[model samples]
Target: ASSRDGYSWTEKQGLKSGVPCIGTIQPPTNLDRASTEVFDVIVVGAGYCGLTAARDLTTSGILVADNPGSRLGLRTLLIEARDRIGGRSWSSDIDGYSFELGGTWIFWGQANVWREILRYQMQDELVSSYDFSKGLNKYILVNTERAQHFTHEEEDEMMESGLRKLVNVDGEYGKRVIPFPHTAAFTAEALRYDKMSVADRLSEIKDSLTPNELSGVEAFVLLCSGGTLETTSFFEFLHWWALSDYSYQGCIDYLVKYKFRGGQSSFAIRFFREALASGNLSYAFNSPVAEIDDTKDFVTVSTRDGKQYRAKRVISAIPLQVMNNVVFNPPLPSGKRTAASIGHVNQCVKVHAEVRNKDLRSYTGIARPENGLFYAFGDGTTPAGNTHIVAFGGQNGHFDPEDNIGTTARKLQGLVPMDIERLVFHNWSKDEFAKGAWFFSQPGLLSNHLGDMRARHGKVIFGSSDWALGWRSFIDGAIEEGTRAALTARTDLAPSQLKGKL
Candidate 1:
């Protein structure tokens, strides 16, 4: 691949942060004129969460009680920092292939995203990374010592045994620790588990597991947390286990098996289109919020460009780690401030590469966190018949994609030998808007700060994927929080409008 093909010798020289796409549509309403008017709702950060909230509010015919029996749509404004729609879930086109630069996979187990797939009639667009019936063609586990290949049966047996032992703290395979995975309900027993980090738990079971089994557990932890085991909460991992029906195979399927035919951008554009069709939704792209002031009367959101917008209610869909950048009028709740300051423990990198190796179409690679490459898998084949692979590595690791393209390719080859051609990626950790890849709660986040993170401050609602109850940090969670925040705003404002208080 050449520079003309969107591949450069260095990322700083040629890698585009986010590609141009149809999702960056201009809302029909003119923002210059709308600035003088107060909207019924202003949704900040036009990610999936904000998009869903704005869509619901603008579409629902909430009655203007002052005019009695007359239904009027709520005026909503969606402000985005980037020119595109999907927040961390973006799809970029490099040459003739589609590379999901951010969040990629989806499954039926993720209820909210699944509903949107059905609603948008995209069920036929679903595709698997590989045929599950045939299983993985190759399984290689890389450690400092060597790279060992295992048969499908051998890998499954070791993975199941190691993972089961890791989470079976109470001898019930995480069920007793997290009986209710979707809820914030934490028993005293659960709190005890919450206090332990992944590293701590691993140490508790390290003696009982074999070396290969231990490495399997380590690879999975590094993949999910994206951070080292010392900081990731054990309870957070347990919650995923319980949600996946307490089976290693189920977790694998739920996490990385299925993806949309085109990309997540297609799914996100559907929400954007629906919101615009409502006739009440207006939007401003390239608007980064600087400050949020809740003045008891209404909320005034000030962008960095010195423009102010007013709204009766505001839903802030900013990512958890990026929240510290914007100043709040009456400072955010103490717990929320603490959580934001501490941040999620997911500082990782995801890189997509095209390799001239058709034989690796069904290969899966996992390496120790200390290695340059932590995990990788064959996604599919490109138009040129090259294998498309997505690889992830932890921050501060040996691999630095931005440093040099040739070095990055060579490092990837160390994990899985392939004739590398081109690579595409986005450094989410360095992104001002994202600050991190995905949310992986730290040790004290759940037990000490979850309720406050979900609570609202005055008229500002916390509707981000970071604190979603069900599938936090996933596309499904973004939709769940977005839908809930919209309904909450409607429920509260309806009565006030009837009483003429708004």
Candidate 2:
């Protein structure tokens, strides 16, 4: 479809101008030169955060009145590595049943995501599901030993008490620590706890907990951290508790239980479609950014294949872990490099398993040490006697993520003792663009590097759930972070004078 040149790039495939190829790119084969497209601002990553940032920045008069010297008539482009736009928020189907392999829940308590739902009148699209903790059977580990079934009421009390002790480090409900969860107000107090890992707290409160209780609590930490909890900061949980309005039950409720009527990916599509229809936005897939260079005036983003895009400013809405993959021309700041070196902890793999049952009880919160997966729960059932369940495993590089069904089914069986008929999943840990699951801050990150991570890097602004204020790991966090990054990128944010550039 090249009218100017007449013939297409027959040397390769899908050589449409401005339309990125929605496939893989092999090295030293096709593209030899980097394409430099100019824009006022170029948003990277097409996930929820990237999409939301693009949408808000495109809205006329939204940031114009607030930003004094900012350009009102701005041209922007969104770049994504994959063909799809949803990023981690993927909604797949098995035997015609809905299964969310990524970020799956949203509620009114998350004011950021709630506002979007209200703005788009998507309340009608909301659907509720059964709680995983209230499941019929229970399989918990006590000192890594599997235990018998316990009633929900009994488990709740033990967990609530244990959780209270975990956050009430000073027995003051974080009054002397993390008093303000929204900003750097509690930086000093937060740092005191930041030096301690989740395991450190578990050891301190070990006396109050039984062996079984301790194991359950440790597993919970693993699930929350997305893998090992030994090195994760204790303050991350406190931040989550504060975000959940100081209620442990609320934290559990928001993480699971609620869902979208249609798939969230569909919602993302609607958002992306609207963005395409409204803004001067153009995008390309199969284009993985490999390098970012910000000079005194303009910024250039380069893909792995040597394609480059130039812009006045760039918003990196990609995952925090993936930052290490991209070569920063001026090497990132030491603080960012330190945090990035440690990286996000949650490399959990979320899988959807189907069992041969017409009616299976939909529940979650099942963990067994032998089983590689950290959690499992029933999602939905099909008329064809297929019961869909979603499962998660935080530890990465432990097994083959490419194995289709049998391997994962066997792993889930060890945890829930279910007879899985078929299994389907997407391993976020294995994803090249997203090296890990949602952000689970490591010890000292919240105190030492979160501010540095969010601080604009010259012409680049960071926008991701990885460093969000409230819902750090949820879709709400991604959207809010993306929107804020875009809106702020247009303004003179009085960004701290970066002492040294990487």
Candidate 3:
């Protein structure tokens, strides 16, 4: 007999005593013989976006009862490709201390995500980073002969000048330096740095930078963009500045004030537990979807095992980079397919190391040509006294894991003098489920594809932090898109009006 947990079964002899035990009739072979089950909505992921959509859609006034004729208030199914929920946001114990593998750190002014944290009553554990008021020292090594340091004042001046050039291009300073998005005055201001590469823009102001200051800015750009200056768009830097009010001080302050004490993974745990308790959602783990076919009346989603699920509406919360892997009948719309094809940014390779000493002050170091590593930062106050330092290396695509660990360690040696006790790193590029850490806009692609990439298709909605209009690569954006997508779905269905007088 078939079982839900996939276990072999046999009937007890005593129950069929009247008939010969060997001749006991087998149970019905067809599992679907009872009735054709149908659901109102089928959310295709269990990430933050999928979970939020499922929760909001179910709790919104519509009710489900045993009676088949009872308006059939929105039945929802949440499926995850992984064996567990929480997608990219994960927290696990490492040496008895909580370590976050993906998506950590949230700032105070994030607005939407902050609201969700408060709504869930998870504010008590919030922690702040090292003091930002007293400017932090920045170090940079550009080849063997160019190692230098920048005072906080010099760094601030350089960044401020860059911002001024970006905003007042046609003013007394000349034409604007970048071509930012023009949706609103704010967006226009944000996009001013879009046209130029960071390296090219820096070259324009190289005369004003002291040797040490130039290296410092170069290092900062690399760390922020996860790539070298030549490849990172100048406009993206300006957009980041605009989001944080054009000041590194403001940006660092924002990051420090909105960190999670236990780590960002705590929020994921809470969300998943609450969703599971709702009793309205069902999940199929380790079940990768092979194909999706949508018709005028219903969408049929098939799994690898040939099992099929039918629903009236579907949401594709997966990232666009991996869209080609899943087959879609008649294919997704040309615009969406094109957006998915051309819109993916490069992947990231990040390394986290635990050192034996905590006395090492928190610092950020940039590597030069002679130096092996480009960036390293002391992660302050981890649960264990072991100093936690994070490094970002390699930007184009997946790197050799064995080669990466050694290369990363050599780079760290240039920054701090500590014995490396253990190391942990994740190459987001290698993960099949997530092809990259987060989506980033290439040079000219932002202007052309940003809008269409985020737009919802007929019955298949799209939502991910990568598509967020505000802080595109942040947790704040994830929550924002999740809520916005749910609202769009609810409004489309108009379930409240069909409740028949409640």
Candidate 4:
């Protein structure tokens, strides 16, 4: 049943054996009692944040048998509901080609992720290994046509200035709105913007932009936020603007300009290796955490299979929307409860496709929501003369990856034009593990829920890129939150500081 590598599947032989070659996995079993019975810390969701938290939590202290230089090491267990790591940042395969079905790109602007890359020595630019968006042609859908016209100079100028004006309070950028962005809390200026949606703010600036400029900015921002401006809060974009130092160009650099040469999964694999090597970190795959009972002094985590694991400290790194489904014994704070009910607004669909064509120009085909395809661009050419392309959809249930990939290709072909071959995508919004894509808050979330939702409750600490102070909804933010949560858990579990500190 074993294939050439862990990823490939063999169908012919498995079919003869009357067993499936590929399918959904069953609940994990055979975990050592040391891992399942109890531990110092148990972190859920094994994604970027969970992995990072577990790594630091387990590695921070020295084992009693190992000279005991530092304090006693915290025994930790990290579990995931999915079969693989990298929660939203999954690097997968399609027809033997490396493809990123989710959270694809990263750049230097993302400090935390960049630090990980540097720590692992994964960056090598001498051979053109990293596909930095240095020379790709920019294209936009104009008037329902893949016209590839309309320059971003005017739009860029407008956006940079507008973003600065939006976040600037007390005549200074980020002074009032996002002073300490990594742990974003409500500020007077932040609350003012949090009350307004992107669409609402657009109304105030509509007269300042030309018609083409307006549409260009609108589509671009829509792609950025993953929903209509009406559903996305201005606070989200304002925070991003501040993260990018109030420059439109810096924001774009982190959003799409850079990518890992081997794929984001490579980073995840490397991260897991470090975490596992840190010691006493056990992980369970194909395990969905259903309930977290913090009723007693110790936290008991229950999986869908009814198995329970106890820990002194717990970090819930799952998606906000999915987190609502998990029953909490004492119940979550009103802020987390209210925010979980509302969830995030982002439902963007990202798809990767290959076409039997040559020299397909790399360009972004932009269109309004329903009139045409949202955006399309070529990733690179495969050895078989097929061009690897990636596309994004802002609306929900409109372009299902399984049922409507063909239609999506045709729509995009009409604008950018390409010979269709094959397509692959995972509907993240429909995915059980992650109910939606990245984080874009609805109106009032920043002012009403973010601060309280971020606070720790009893022995449980919540961490997600959804509310990260910087790089919200991104892998960078995930790392920031995970690293912070791990540190918080360590402090709370440490004997010297155990009186509910953190």
The candidate scoring highest on lDDT is 1
Residue 60, model 2: lDDT of 39
Q: After best superposition, candidate 1 residue 21: deviation in angstroms?
A: 3.2
Candidates 1 and 4: which is better by TM-score? 1
Q: Which ten residues in a row have the lowest lDDT in candidate 2?
A: 1-10
Candidate 3: stretches off by over 4 Å: 1-36, 62-73, 131-195, 255-257, 369-372, 382-384, 396-398, 401-404, 495-502
Q: lDDT, candidate 2, residue 92?
A: 50
lDDT of each: 0.81, 0.68, 0.59, 0.69
What C-alpha RMSD separates each model from the true structure? Answer: 3.2, 8.1, 10.7, 5.3
The residue pairs in collision within model 2 are: 34-306, 132-364, 330-502, 331-502
**Residue 444: error of model 4 in Å?**
0.7
The local lDDT score (0 to 100) that residue 283 gets in candidate 1 is 86
Residue pairs with backbone overlap in model 1: none
Candidates in descending lDDT order: 1, 4, 2, 3
Write candidate 1's Cα lDDT for 1-502 as tens digits.
1111112232334554345454655542347753588888999988889988988888886644455643556889988887778888877655566778788899998899889999899999988876423334778888884889876678789989999999988889987778887898887877887788989988877899999899888888878888888888998888888878899998888888889768888899898888889788888877899999997698999999998999999999999898989999999988889999988988778888887778777788787746666788889778888888888887537345777776777668767888777677777777789988889987888899889889999999989889998898888899999999998888777876666444
Q: Clashing pairs in model 4?
A: 141-366
What is the TM-score (0 to 1) of candidate 2?
0.84
lDDT of 4 by residue, 386-474 (tens): 77777777663355545544466666665566676656566777788887788888888877887776888888999988878778789
